[model samples]
Target chain A: MEELLANPYVGPLVLTVAIILVFPLIVGYMVLAERKVLADLQVRLGPMRVGPYGVLQPLADALKLLLKEDIIPARADKWIFWLAPVLSVFTGLTALAVLPLSDRLYVADVNIGILFILAMSSIGALGLILGGWSANSKYSLMGSLRAAAQMVSYEVPLGFATVTAIMCAGTLSMQGVIDSQFERGVWGAFDNYGLMLIPTVLFIIAGTAETNRAPFDLPEAESELVAGFHTEYSGFRWSLFFLAEYAAIVVISALCVTLFFGGWLRPFPNVELLEIPFNTVFPAGLCLLIAFGCLKGVGKQVVPGFRFLMAAIAAAFLGAAGLFVLPLTNELVIGLFWFAFKLGVMVYLFIWYRGTFPRFRYDQLMDVGWKWLIPISMAGLVLNGAVQLLARG
Target chain B: MLIDQVLFYVLAVLILGSAVMTITRRNVVYSAVWLISTLVGVAGIFLLQGAEFLAGVQVIVYIGGIMVLFLFVIMLVPLEEEASQRRFSNQKWLALATGLAVLAMLAVIVVRGIGSLDHPGPAPPPGPASLTQNSEAVGRVLFTEYLLPFELASILLLVAIIGAIVMSKARRRQTES
Candidate 1:
């Protein structure tokens, strides 16, 4: 067992399995969180039926999707239809392999890390295109056509934005990017007299569009395209596409966090006085506060079973808080906590945009992607490159 | 060592098999999809050779960018008519002869190329040092030795882009008039 643990390959292999298993659950909870956030924005209770505020909703959804009758359009290309969702999920999950979850936690620190992610995403786009094309419906074809065009267009600005960070960091590896930010004593977004903020903003905007979220979600604009590329998909097959979309969102959020927000580094990482507070006090306090909120909700549940479930959840949160301050585990989980915190912030921003913004018209989407984002990102890349050169000199 | 050999053979079979499927597929979209698999296989080969950057670029440029555009164009073509058409041209024999001639030329080149090598049993696996420095080494050589050629290539691409835009605008204007 010790030997197996010591083996270099075993660690990554285990991490890979863990991520493949745990990621879907994370994505499921993220969906619940999105619904809750969107509900809060609109002033309503989002989902309250399943397990005290719909905590078990994702699992129920998964089970229902699994047991539901699978349907394929009569005219759909049998092989390609079967292949598409699998392709989407595969590429989405594969991109996670290179993500530097923490300094000590990751699958593989490959040389071409960020490029691997970008390439995987590009292939994921193929899955969308193929899914739409194979569906044999006019709406599906149109949705896919829009998907291909939008991904290709936004990729330009996304590439340029990423290039700015790559230039500043001078390395393609994910861990190296974080370490460089640590060494520089600032996040990539705060570098270059705040000029780096241009790419930071560009990255976020293009990333949102790239993921086909609202205001840029012409491909899947429900009123028009009728659920977009996966219009004909149903049951487990449809859920796979849904899983891929959420997975892509998480991947993008992770990328944004890793590139700009400093992957695992706490804010003001070099400040000695801030370290203990940010590392220990902040995380523990936040968990305790959430636990307290959960505890307060227990009295509101009239049913004994529901109230007990609420208390159990609050107890779980309290245990989590306790784990945060525990000497051994605290050191281990600190990096992961900050990375997750920043990632959650990015994910929340995505949900917030979905709630706040109206969907873009197709032509308007193209216009924004081409005219505004592309040019700004290009100029930002050049300016950041010049700043880095001057700073080096 | 055994795993490396097995992986190489697997990738080779994948590339060759998909290349054949690409040309043989009746539907244009299927052909394009098959060609993507072939490109992915080639990228795998590049990775096996320890050229991670090249593998990534191959996927990004060929399968991701170029093939997506190809599919867009393919969508306009009526696949029903394409599949209904004859599989082979009238000049199949002539084409076969020409293909064989080209194969002969390639074989000759390979034979002569191998003769020039000092000690080549597939050229030993690259050392760890070279594997890690692959990208940096490529960048250094590209910026120094082949700098002018690299710049020229970029210029050529820029020219192509401008020419395409000009042609597109002209056609659009003619249609409007």
Candidate 2:
């Protein structure tokens, strides 16, 4: 089993399946998370009846969507119409190929991982463009056009910001960038300056715009375009579009964790304490001990002969001792915990933004992408170059 | 030997099929998509030739950027179904004959070129860095040795931008006037 897990193809295939199965669940709960956060901010009670603190809301929403009737507009271009949502979902999934959730966990560690991500994301705008155009509705067409223009404009600044990070790290590989941060014991964006300063702030702003989050979601301004490009879509198709949107938010969050935060790197500088687990095979021993304890307990319950109950009690005590020794295990488990914590912070920020900000107007959105973001990203690139040069000198 | 031949034939068929579709498709948008497929096939050929950077750039610049602009233009055009179907009758046969003759001539030239390269020569040096470094290397070289040409390209882009704005704005003025 250990050898199987270590196989290259097996790991990616397993991770892919896991991501596919887990993402919808995450998205469902994220909806609840969003509502709860928003309700807290607005001083109102969120959903409570369905499940404890509205835990079952996402499942109910999924059921509703599953039961809804699918609709296709009469005048829609049928071929492109079918292709658009598929393309959106496919592009979102492809971006996951490079995302590293933990130190040794990733789908493919391509040398040009960053470029691969950018290229895949470039295809996503096509989904919006085709969705609107194929619908043959004036409103849908306008919304899609706005989406295309907004994405194109924002992508430049986003790419520039990414280039700034890449230049500073001197590598296009995501793992390489993360490892650089780990080596320094500081997040890449905060290595020189303090937190909430220049380039990091620029990255966050650009990332938000790139993902079409609040204050930048001009494409789907509900009041104006009636849910924008996917307005004509219904049921499963519309759900797919929502899935793509949420997935995109998740991708950007993961990227922020990998690029700006020390991905899977423990916050503390010294890792000597963390490495203590490597000295002993505690987990393996614990697993064997637990199995023996389980068998003894079962034997005690089924057969009341030879004082089995007392022997089982002793076995349980030994298993509990093994459990207590888990902290003395390896850096691998600690690294996984640190990675999850960083990703959680990034995910929390996405929810925070959704709850706090209002959507931007079309003109204001364009102005931010062009006037503000582009200039800042360009300046950030220059700053990164200067820093690198000075460091070398 | 059979596998190699099959691979070559398959790529050739795809290249030809997409090129034909690009020209023959009545819908401008569909034609643009067909053109993208043709570009993708060309990138595949580049990959076969060990020109990974060239293949990537072909996809990025032609398929991703330029074809996107083509799609935009096609979408912007107020082309009706009847107007799209109307063919120019003035030089239809003449144009077809000329096109076929040119194709035949190019095929002959290509065959002759291939025949002359029967003997394999020394291989080219390994590529400088991986495919990922292509853009960075090109940027460095262009900004240093080819600085003048790089500046010229920028100027050309500027002019095109100005020209596009002028053309679009001129139409508005004409409508108003």
Candidate 3:
């Protein structure tokens, strides 16, 4: 078993399978989180009926989607329509292969790691474009047209911003970027007298546009386009598109964290005095805090089932905190904890953007992508490049 | 060794088959999709050759950037009339002549290099260690050995982009006036 585990190919293969299986659950919970967060921002209780605070809402949603009748428009280009959602989901998940979750945990450490993600995103664009065009509906076609133009325009700034990170790291590999950050004893966002923040901000904006989240979600402007490209899609097919969107959201957030944040490294990684507390205690304490929140909610629940569920969740979080403190699991959990923590923060920012901002007008979206983002990102690139050169000299 | 050969042949077949389908499709959108498949197959071949950076650039620039533009153009055009019109059916002889010329050129190149197949040069040191350095090697050569040509290519692409914008702007002005 040890020999098998040591085989490089076997390890990555197992990791690949694990990511594929686990990511959907993560994405599902992310959807619930988005709803819950959006609800909180709107000052309301959201989906309290499904599970304790709608914890099982994603599972219920998944079952409903799975059991619903799949529909394809009669006039649609059947093959392309069928292929679109699969393409979206496939490219979204495939991009995960290059995402270095930690130094030790990743599927494949390809030399062109970031570029691979970029390429997958480009293909993911194809899924949207094709889905829109194939639907044979006017709205679908218009949505796709917007998607193609928007993605193409936003990608310019996104590429330039990524170039900024790549230049700082002097490598395209994701793991290499984090290692360089560690070596420099600063996150990419904090590098070069904080000039790197320009690209960091540009990346977040461009990434938001790239993923078609508000205020840049012109392609799927529900009020105008009636659900946009997936208008003709229903049931299982629509769910696939939803899955792909959330998967993309997660992937882009992970990319943002990996590029600007210190990735799996704890904040202030080189501060030896704080290392034990930050690495070991902080993670467990965070979980315990969440458990405490759950415990507080247990007394307020009117339903016995809801109260029991709340307590059970509190227990689960307590157990998780327990695992974090255990000697055997401490080191194993630390890296994943930091990575997920950073990732969660980024994901929350996305949800926050959605709740706060109104959608951009179509022309306004194009203006932002071209008139603002591209030039700013380009300038950021040149500035960071100059700073790096001078620092090296 | 066996897996490498198998992957190579599989990718080659996919590339060739998809290229054929790309031309044969009646629907322009279908043709565009097939072209993407062909590009992806080519990218797979590049990956199989251990040129990871080249493989990535192939997918990014070709399949991602170029092909999306192609699809956008194809969709913007009214294809129903074009589909009804005879394409290669009318230009069969001209097509055949051009195809033969290209085939002859390729054949000549292949024949010239055929001798090396039996005594092919040593493969690049194949392992994960060397594989991970593929992009570094590419970056070094591109920036140092072929820097001028690379810059020239970028300038040329810039010129094309500007020319396209100018031409489109000119047409829009004509329509407005």
**Evaluated with lDDT, which candidate comes out highest?**
1
Candidate 1 vs 3: which has more lDDT: 1
Q: What TM-score would chain A of each candidate receive against the reference chain A?
A: 0.99, 0.83, 0.98
lDDT string, candidate 3, A1-393, tens digits:
999987768988888899889888888899999999999999998877797778999999989988998888888999999999999999999998888787788887778889899989999999999999999998998899899998889999999999999999888888889999999999999899999999899999999999999888888899999988889998888888988998888889889898899899999888899987997688889889999999999988898988998999999999999988897887777888888899999989999999999999988888888899998998999998998899988
TM-score of each: 0.96, 0.79, 0.97
lDDT of 1 by residue, A1-393 (tens): 999887777888888899999988998899999999999999999988998889889999889999999998998899999989999999999999989888899888887998999999999999999999999998899889999999999999999999999888888888989999999998999999999999999999999999999978888889988989889999999889988998889899999899999999999999999977898899999999999999999988888988998899889989989888998999898889999999999999999999999998888898998999999999998898888889888
Candidate 1 docking: what grade? medium
Between candidates 1 and 2, the one scoring higher on DockQ is: 1
Off by over 4 Å in 1: B87-102, B115-131
Local distance difference test, candidate 3: 0.89
Report the lDDT of model 3 for residue A237. Answer: 86
In DockQ terms, which candidate is top?
A: 3
Q: Enumerate the candidates' DockQ scores in order.
A: 0.50, 0.22, 0.60
Distance (Å) between predicted and true CA of A337, model 1?
0.5
- Regions more than 4 Å wrong, model 2: A1-7, A192-197, A268-330, B1-15, B39-64, B79-151, B165-177
Please list the C-alpha lDDT of all candidates, in the order they appear: 0.90, 0.72, 0.89
> TM-score ranking from best to worst?
3, 1, 2
lDDT value, candidate 2, whole model = 0.72
What would the DockQ be for model 3? 0.60
